[model samples]
Target: MGTFSDPTFRDLMAQRPFLRLWAARLAGTSANQMLMVALGWQMYDLTGSAWDLGLIGLYQFVPALTLTLWAGHVVDRHHRGRIVAACLATQCIAAIVLMAASRGHWASRELLLGMSLVFGSVRAFQMTAQQALTPLLVPMNLLQRAMAFSAAGTQVAIIGGPALGGLVFVFGADKVYGLGAALLAVSCILILLLRYTYVALPREPASLATVLAGVRFIWQHKVVLGAVSLDLFAVLLGGAVALLPMFARDILHVGPEGLGLLRAAPAVGAVIVSVVLSRWPLRQHVGRTLLIAVALFGLCMVVFGLSTSFLMSLLALGVSGGADMVNVVIRQTLVQMETPDTMRGRVGAVNSVFIGASNQLGEFESGATAALLGPVGSVVAGGIGTILVAISWRHLFPALAKRDGLQAR
Candidate 1:
C-alpha cells in the first residue's frame, strides 16, 4: 500500500492533461448533483407526490436509453473532450433556463421534467466521452489508480454538492440552480482547456451492427457481461435515492437541510473508500471482494429501510456508500482493462445505460413500488432483492465469482 505522498500518486497528480480532465469532471459532477437535489426537492414540494418525483427520474432515463448507443458512435468518431465540453455547455444552458424559470415563477412540474429530458440527452454523450477519454490521458498501467482517484473526486462532489444545494435552498431553489449553472460553466471551460493525444480513426459508416457492437461484445465476454449486469440488477433493486425526499420530509422529519445530509452520507463513505483504493489498488480476490461488497450494500439498505432514527439511517446509507464505491472501482477497472480503446466509447455507453437504468429508472421503480408498498415496504423489499441478485449472480456467472484480479490474464 502506498501513502498519500507515494511517487505513483504524485505522478498521477502531476499529469497536467489528466489533472485538467479530473478538475472538469469534479466541477461538472458537482453541478449535476446540485441540479438533481434542487429538482427532486422542488418536484416533491410542488406535488407532494411520490409518483411525480419518480417521474423526474423516468424522464431522464428515457432519453439516455434512447440516445446513448448513438451517442457512443459519435464519441468514437469525434473528439471526446469536445463532446464532454459540449455536454457541459448544454447542461449549463439548462441550469440557466431553470434558474430563470424559478425566479420568474414560471417553473412548473412540466418545466422540470422537460429540463430533465435535456439533461438525460446530454449525459448520454458526456459519460461515454469521459470514460473513453480517460485512458488516453494517463499510462495504461495507471488506469486503475486513475479511476479510483477520479472516483474520489466524484465522491467529493457528491458529498458537497447536495450539502451545498441544501444550504442554498434556504435562499431559494433558484439560487441553487444559479450556482449549479456557474459550476457547470466553469467545468465546460476546464474541458475546453484540456489537451490529450488523439488519433483519428477511419470513419465508419453508421449501421445497426456498429451501434450494437458494444452490446454484442459484452455478451461475448462473459466476465464483462457478469460485471456490468451485476451492477444493473443489484443497484436496480437496492437504489433508495428517489424516495429520499419523502424520507426527509415525512419519515425522518428532517427538512431539506437534513435531506442534504442524507444525500451526502453515501458519498462520505464513498470518498473515504475511494481514497484508500487509490493508494492500495486491489490486487487479489477482486471478484469475491466485489460480491461481498454488493451483499454488504444490500444489508445496509435493509438496515436503512427499517430504521426510524435519523442517525441510524445516515449510518446505514454511509456504509452502503462505502460498499458501493468498492463495487464501482472494481467494475470500472475490469471493464476498461478488458476492452480495446476503439470500442471503449461504445462499451462505456452501454455501461452508462446500465448505470442510468440502475439510477434513473431505478428511481422510477422505487416511486412506483413506494406507491404500492409504502416507502418502508418498498425499500425493505428492494434490499432483500438486491442481496438475492448478488447470490444469484455468484452462481450464474461462476467465472466472475472465481476471478482474481483487475487486469485481464
Candidate 2:
C-alpha cells in the first residue's frame, strides 16, 4: 500500500501530460472492459453455445491481425492524439450501432460479428497510438510507475465495467452500449486535455525501408522480442477467461451476476498486484521476477482448470491473474523503457501483434482445444503447455534473461 499511497509517486503525475494521459487511459479502458462483458453476454444470449462465442472471437481477430502493420505505420506517421480520437469515435459509432441492433427485433449473429470486426480494427490502431504516447508523457525513471498507473486504470475499468455491464444487460442491451459509448466519448474529450503539443512524425514517408527497419530492430533486440514472446505464448496457451460463460452456465451453474464476478476476479487480483508494484517497485532481479511470475501463472491455470466449483475457479483465476500482473509489469517496463524515441509507433505495433497473438488468436486456440478435449481438459493441457514453453524458452534464449534492463542492457 505504501507504493500506491505514497505522496512521492502521486506527485509524479504533477505534470499535465501524465494527468491527462492517466484520465484518458482510465476512461478508455473502462469502456473497453464494458464491451468485453457486453460482447460475451450478448453473443451467448444469441447463440447459447461456446462454439458461437468462439466464432465471435474469430471475426474479431481477422481485422485485429490484418490491419496491425498498416495501423502501426500510420500511427508512426500521424498525430497520435488525433489517431486515438478517431479510433474512439469509430468505436463510439460501433457501440451505438450495436445498441440499435440489440434493441431491434431483427438482430442476427452475422451482423454482430461484422460490428466486432470494425471495433477490433479500430481498437488495434487506438492501442498502438496510446502505447506510443506513454514514453512521451513521462520520463524514463518513471516508466515502471507509469505502467502501474496504466494497469490500475485498466483494472478499475475491468472490475467496474463488467460488474456494471452485468447489471445494465438486465435493463437492455441499449443501456449497456450507452454506458460503453459514454465512457469512450468521455475518453475522446479527456485526451484533448493533453498539455504537450507533440509534433507528428516527420514527412519522410517510408516505403519498405521503415517497415523492415522496425521489424529487424525488434528481431535483433532479444530483450524486446523475448518479453513480448513470453506474453504471446503464455496467454495464448493459458488464457481461460475467454471461456468464462461456459463455466458460468454449464459447469458452475451461475447466472450473469456470478459470471461478472468470475470475469472480474482476475482484474481484482491484477489491481492488488499493480498497487503493490506502484508502491514498492519490482526491486532488482527483473529477469528472474518475470520468469517466476510466468511460471506461477502456468501453475494457477492448471489449478483453475481442474476445479469444478465456482469458488475454486475464481480462486484459480485470481491466482493466474496475480501472476500475470507481475509478468505484465515486467514486460511493459521492458518495452517502454527499451524502445527508441523514433521507433515507438512501429515498435508498439509489433508489441500489439504479440498481444493479438496472445488474446484473440489465443481465444481461437482455446476454442479449438475445448472442442478437441473438453473445456476442463483443454485448460489443463494449455496450462501445461505454457509451463513447458517457459522452460524451453529459458534454455533456448538464455541471453534474454541475462540481458540488462532498458537501453543499457
Candidate 3:
C-alpha cells in the first residue's frame, strides 16, 4: 500500500498505455545496448584498430544524418506507434541476420558495418516517432515525471544490456545477436499493443519549405536550441566513449567482462539519479542546473581520462554519468514542453540529428585523435574541450542561462 504512495511510480502504473510504452522502450533499448557492446568488441577483436572502431560510429551516423529530415516528416504524418513497431521489427530482422552470419563464421568487418548502417537508418525514423509520441501518452502536468521514469527505464537497460552482452559473448557472439533479436521482437509486440493516434498537422506539399521548418523552429527557440546544442557540442568534444574498448582491453587489462562493467558504470550512476528525479523533479534555475551538471560532467571526464586504476576509473565515469542524467532530463523536458504537438516530430528530429551527430562524429573524433595522440591524451584533451564548450555556451545562450524553471514559457 505504501508503495502506491510514490507519485511517480503510481502515475506510471495508472497509465496502462504509458506503462506499455515504457516496457517496450526498456526492451528495445536493452537490445540495442547489448548489440552495441557486441559490435564494439567484435570490431576491436577483428581489426585491432581504433580507426576501424571509429568507422562503426561513422557507418551508423551517415544514414541517420541523411534520412533524418525525411524521416521526421513521415513521422509527423503517420501513426507513431505503428512506425516504432515496424522499426523494431526491422531491427530484429537485422539482428537475426547478424546472428546467422556470426553463427556461420561469416561475420566480418564489412558485414558489421553494413548492419550498423541499416540499424542507424531505422533508428533515425524510430527515434523521431518515439520522442513525439511520449508527450501524447500522459497528462501535461506529469510529463516531467514521465520523462524521468522513461529515462530510468533506459538507464536500467543500459545497466543490464552490456553485462548481459558480455556474459552472452562468452558463449558466442552469435548468441548475443540472437538474444538481441529476441528482445527486439518483444519490444515490437509491446509497442503494437499501445493505444493512441497522433493528431497530425495538415499535410503540406513536400517541399524544402515544409521540411526545413523544424530547423528554423529550433534556431528560433533559444532555450531549446541552446540546450540541444550544448549537449551536442559538449559530447561531441568529449569523446570518451569512443576509446572505451581500448581502455577495457589494452589499458585496464580486462577482457569483455571488464568492458561490460565499464559500459555499465555510467548507467549505474544514471539510474540512481533518474529514480531520485522521478520522486522530486528539479524546479528552480533549471537552466543553470543543466549548465553546472554539464561542467561537472566535463570535470569527471578529465578525472576518468587520467585514472589508471579500474575502480577509480569506474567512479569517475559513474559521476560523469550522473551529471549527464541531469542534462538529459531537463533538456528533454524543455524540448517537449515548449513545442506544440504539430511541431513535436519535426523538432524532435532536429534534436535527434544533433544527438546522433555528437555521438557518431564524436566517436570518429576520438578514434582519430587517439591515433594521433594516444588514448590517454585524446581523452584528456576532449575533456578540456568539453569544459570550454560549457563556458562558451553559457555566455552565448543567455536565454537558457537566464531561465528559471522547467515549465513552458
By TM-score, how accurate is candidate 2?
0.87
TM-score against truth, every candidate: 0.88, 0.87, 0.88
TM-score of 1: 0.88
Itemize residue pairs with steric clashes in candidate 1: none
Candidate 1, backbone clash total: 0
lDDT of each: 0.90, 0.80, 0.88
Q: Report the Cα lDDT for residue 36, model 1.
A: 95
Give the clash count for each candidate. 0, 1, 0
Q: Model 2 misses residue 79 by how many Å?
A: 1.4
> What does candidate 2's lDDT look like per residue over 305-358, in tens digits?
888788888888887888899889888888777777677888888888888777
lDDT of 3 at 200: 59
Which residue ranges in model 1 land beyond 4 Å of their true spot? 37-56, 97-114, 169-178, 244-259, 364-377
Pairs clashing in candidate 2?
A: 3-279
